[model samples]
Target: MPRLQGVDIPTDRPTAVSLTYLYGVGPKTARELCLKAGVDPVARARELTEDEVARLAALLDKDYTVEGQLRRQVTQNISRLRDIACYRGIRHRRGLPVRGQRTKTNARTRKGPKKTVAGKKGVKDLR
Candidate 1:
């Protein structure tokens, strides 16, 4: 594995694909990085020379906030929202969906496992 921006990228994968292992770097960004760095996107990461890796690191540092920096920025943004008590922040605080997804169903991912109420079985007798 070749290390870039303090992260070890997969050596067997294509350069563009391997770049996606870094935080905040998607396929599009990886493609752009390869283009700007003049590195071959289809080449395996391990095939890259030290010069190519240096160029990539320089480009990443100059043009993008990635790795730990990106994660910190995102966390700060969310924390700022929470501090302001905005709707989105409130959702974050409550651990609910923030993008207006229906919570009545299909939100189990955010809502977590079901907490069954105890009285449902006896409700039929009352009725």
Candidate 2:
């Protein structure tokens, strides 16, 4: 594995694919990085030379907000929203879907497991 920006990219995959392992670098960005670094995007990560790795790392550091920095920036943005108590901020604070997703169904990922309420009594049973 090649360590770039404090993350270990998979050596078994192509360099472009491996670069996606780093936070905030997706396929398009990975290809761009390979191009910018003058490294072969299709080359296996394990086959990259030390100088090539250094160029990739340097490019990432200089041109991109990635890894810990990106994580911190996102958290900070959310926290700022929370502090302002906007609708979106409230959603974030409450652990609900923030993107106008219908919470009536299919929000299990954000809403967690269902907490079923007790069924209402039947009219006959109440009588």
Candidate 3:
């Protein structure tokens, strides 16, 4: 494992792929970082020299908001939305999908297990 920006990137994968382990960094961003840092994207993480790792870390710290900072920024944005009572904010506050995903069917991950309600008549038997 190679530690970069407080995260340990997997040594088994290519540098580009391993860099994606950092928060807010994806394959595209990782490739861009490698390009800017003059690192070989296809190189394995363990194969990187100290100077190369230093360059990668410097580029990320100087030009990108990632890891804890990115997470905090996102949470703050969500909280701002919630405080403003926006539609998306309400969804977050209510623990529902926020991106116009239909809740009538496949929102189980957000809605959690169905809460069974006792019915007055034959509704229970319908199950």
Candidate 2 regions with alpha-carbon error over 4 angstroms: 114-127
* Candidate 1 deviation (Cα RMSD): 3.8
lDDT of 2: 0.92
**Candidate 3: count of backbone clashes, pairs at least 3 residues apart or interchain:** 0
TM-score for all models, in order of appearance: 0.83, 0.86, 0.85
Q: Write the per-residue lDDT of candidate 3 for residues 1-127, one digit (tens) a residue.
A: 6799889899999999999999999999999999999999998999999999999999999999999999999999999999999999999988888998888885598778876656645535655
Find the candidate with the highest TM-score and give its number: 2
Q: What is the C-alpha lDDT profile of model 2 across 37-124, one tens digit per residue?
A: 9999998999999999999999999999999999999999999999999999999988888998888876598788875558865458
Tens-digit lDDT track of model 1 for 1-127: 6798889999999999999999999999999999999999999999999999999999999999998898999999999999999999999998888988898776597778876766676435654
Each prediction's whole-model lDDT (CA): 0.92, 0.92, 0.91
Which parts of model 1 have CA positions greater than 4 angstroms off? Answer: 113-127
Worst 10 residues of 3 by lDDT: 118-127
What is the Cα-based TM-score of model 2? 0.86
